[model samples]
Target: MRLLMLGFNHRTAPLELREALAFDNERAAAALHELRQRYPASECALLSTCNRTEFYLARPIHDPPTIEHLRSFITQQTGADADAIHTASIHREQEEAATHLFRVSAGLDSMVLGEPQVLGQVKRAYELADGCGAVGPVLHRLFQGAITASKSVRRQTGIDQGRTSVSSVAVAFAKNIFDHFGDKTVLAIGAGEMIKASLASLRRENPKRLLLINRTQQRAIDLAKQLELTGTDHGGRAWDDMDSLLIEADIVVSCTGATEPIVTESRFKPLLKKRRGRPLFMLDLAVPRDLDPKIGSLRNVYLYNLDDLQQAVEATTSGRRELVNEAEALLRGHIDRCMGEIRHRDIGRLVKQLRQRLNDIAQEEQGRTAKKLASLNGQSTEQAVEDLIAQHNHRLVNKILHLPLSQLDRSDPDASMGFYAAALRRLFDLKDQPDMPMDEASSDT
Candidate 1:
């Protein structure tokens, strides 16, 4: 089987493109099924997140559905422009595909380098595909390897030692402003993922209270329940109560989906007197910015947007460059080991085929010998003698295989082993099995 990975990530595509291609769990499940239908024997998975949308496929090396076929499928599925996708996406095959997945699972390709969430995301994607019967042996091994490699890299390197996520960085900045969250009230104004992540990071500080509010009050309540924000002190509140809550809130994290700013300066400036000059730290993690830009001008209002959070993340990442290099090397080693195992599996299959072939030939020759002996003597040989002859043939076959089998057992499961397996297959006239493509475009349509 050949592996093919095609994707658009933060570095390769704009947010609009990523958003357009993004798939929720239900959509992802449906997409996997559709991909299976389109390429009946192919194994497929779709991984869609805020900053990326990737498709990983494993199929016969000479299959009908190639990279272009997959691209067309995606275009039809998502209604994205073919030319735009072609320009923004990347295509990788075989080892390159595996390498990219390893990087992604390890958060090397994330906007916030070494972020932990991508590992879970990768696992979830794999599970989703597997659940839909879109995963086979090749994908099962590849994804499992990626997940394990991610863990190994994290355990071996300092890349994930500190706060790496944007949400965590925002919380770290909040720490710089406030000595502690023990007496502080944190009001999170949204039920979106950014708000949820920010709330999770903030929860570690054990804040005095967490107030959740959304345009839809029930959504805020549902979010509170999902986050396990129990107790009367940490619960959802009405959107209309936001103004009153703002007076008591020491920190406000807003990441709503509104096209315009949710907290305008005009609406918030009058509430400042109620605060009595107390500092209010605000983090705006929304795409269009939930907090108005002018809110930063207000006295004692510390406003930081997504760009600010990204800067903090970048600063943290910059200091870990050496650690990242170490992580990269670790990932490469894991990939090598994984590839070796796959090659070893191929060799094992070939060996099984060889053993079966030899056994079939032995059985055929035994029947022929029995017929000739019976004809020569004009009587059938005794059952005991026939059984003895059969035992001898089995022993002879085993003896013939002993040296090669022992050599194969001792051989390292590396490129050299792959070469040996190929040579043996050719020598024995065994059925040809496709290895992962060597050429970058070998699996192209």
Candidate 2:
């Protein structure tokens, strides 16, 4: 079987396209079944996250699914034209697919390089696909190996030693501002995508109160409910009473898509007076920041724009470039190893076929000799015939294995052994047989 990985990621597509293609668990499972139906050779698993959407498949090499087939699958599931989105998608075959998956699982592919959450997300996606019965041996082995490789990379490299990115930097800034998040009241402004990611990061700190404040009351309520369901230690509250929520909030993180600032100095001046110099840590993650630039000038008000957090993140990432390079080289080595294993499996199959062919010939010759001896043989003649048949079988087996054995010894240890094994099998017309032990056949070589 040939392995395939096709999808779009943060590097290949913008958030707009990624969001359009994102699949929740139910949708992803349904899509997997649909892909299998559309391409009989495809044994598939769909992985969709905020940063990426990918499909891992194993199919017959002779009838491998085409780029057009993958495009159609995506178009049918997402209602986006394949022609328009195809440029954003990448196609990987066999070794490339394995390498891509390893990097993804290790979080090297993340927008925030080496972020830890992505590894968990990949594991969850694999589990969901496996539970849905959408995964077969090839995909199963590939994902499992990818997970192991990811763990190894993380353990061996310092790539994930620090927090970087707007959300993470915001959380770190919070820690610097407050002794404990559990004692601070958090007010989230707008239900933007980044806000959701920020909340996921913030929730880990077990904040005291997690409040959702959006222009739409329903959106705020929905976010509050989701945060609650995700088992956050914080008590979640909707911002139907926005004034009261704002007045009470100790920290505010805003990531709205508004063209202009949502919270000006004038808006917070009265609230700051009412709180009597109590510090308000405000993170304005919006590109055109949600908070007014003047807010930073207000007393007891700490307002940081996206640029500040971005600078911090960039500094951290720059320091870790060496680790990133090391991690990448490690990933490449793993890809090579996995490909070598796959090639070895193929060679083993070929060897088994060749051995079976010789066994068939030996059995046939022994049957013919026994039949001829049946009419005239004493016990000694029958025994002699059996010995002669055994000797011929040994010679035949030796001749068939000679070339493969030499190649196996001399060929690059990391190169595919399957090609030579397959050649031997095809030449000998050896059909694979059931109930044969691999070690016994391999030992003969």
Candidate 3:
């Protein structure tokens, strides 16, 4: 079977297109089912997230589907047109596909380089596909190898060593504004992972109080309960009370899923008056942003969005670039170790069997020649024995060389086969070298 990894990622596609094709883990199994139905002979797995949507497939070797066919399948399923898929997709087969997946699982291919979330995302997608019977031998091997490489990268390199992700980076930025977090009231908007991650960072600071307001009441309550149970001062309220809470909060972090700004210039302009000129820092981590762009222009207001945080992210990434080289070396070591083990097992067995077969044929031919000489010529025992031994040795040498010569004469060769052929040439004195011996008999007529 041939492996195929086809996908559109943040580097290739815009955020709008990526979000349009986003699929959560809860829907992953169903997506795998759809993929299997479309290509029954193939084994498939789907990985989707905010930045990427990828299909890892294994097709029958003889009649594999084209890259265009896979792209069309995605376009039809995701409601994207041909042009949208055309500019934002790449397909890699076999070795290249494996390498791409290794880099992805290592977080090397992430929008935020070396971010830990992408590996977990891939693990979740892989588990769901396997649970749904969509993953076969090749995919299981492929993902397990990738996961193993990811683990090595984490342990062997410093690429993921610092405060990573937008949430954590935003929290780092917040520290620069506020001298101490213990006196601050941190208000978090929405119940999405961005807020959850921000809460994690804020909790680490031991903030005086935590406030949560989500569109869903229970979600806010759930987060509040979780924070309270973890020994953090916390409370939750309906979304309507958000404006009033904003007045009390020293720092506000919001990442909601609204298409438009939830906190506009008009809405927030009045809150500034009630606050009595207390400097407030707001971190907007949402895509399409929860806070209005003009909010940054307000007096005594510090606002930072995802775009503004690129300098910090780039600084962090630049530090990790050196570690990336070490991590890549570790990953290649793993791949080579695995491929070498498989090659040894398969080729070692074949070599053993072929040597045994050649020995049997050589012994049979030697017996036939000895019997014919005894039957027809009636030669003296000593001379006949000597002739038979010399001829048998010559025949064995010629027979062993037949296949090697055939392989060497081929104009083009498979990579694996060519390796073996070159090895044979070196093993015997077969190459055209100054020190090589000629194939002349030691004892002859």
List the lowest-lDDT window of 10 residues for candidate 1.
Answer: 406-415
Evaluated against the true structure, the overall lDDT of model 1 is: 0.84
Clashes of each: 0, 1, 0
Cα lDDT of model 1 by residue, 319-354, tens digit:
677887888988989899877776677678779987
Encode model 3's per-residue lDDT on 1-445: one tens digit a residue: 6788899876787656765666656655777888788788888889886567899998777665668888887777778778988888988987778878889999888766777877888898898899989988778778888898898788777576673777778878988888888988889998877678788888888889888999997898898777563344677778999899889888999887765789999999999999999889998876556888799999989998755565577677775666778877888877666545534554776689888988887888778777866775655687777787788777777777776666766564553666776687787757755643445433331
User: Model-by-model lDDT, in order?
Assistant: 0.84, 0.76, 0.79
| TM-scores for every predicted model | 0.65, 0.60, 0.66
Pairs that clash in candidate 2 = 347-418
| Candidate 2 local lDDT, 1-445, one digit each (tens) | 7888889876677545665787877888888777777776667887776567898888877785776777787898888767667889998988888888999988787767787767887888899888877777677778888888899999899666674756888888887878887777888898866788788788888777787877776776677677673345333455456667667788888987565678877776777777767888998866445688898998878888655664576667766778888998998877777777777776787689867987776677667666756744565675777776676677666766665677766447864578876776797797766776989889988
The prediction achieving the highest TM-score against the true structure is: 3
- Candidate 2 wrong stretches, greater than 4 Å: 171-185, 188-234, 238-316, 350-445
RMSD of 2: 11.8
Worst 10 residues of 3 by lDDT: 436-445
Highest lDDT against the true fold, candidate: 1
Query: Which should have the higher lDDT, number 2 or number 3?
Result: 3
Model 2: what TM-score? 0.60
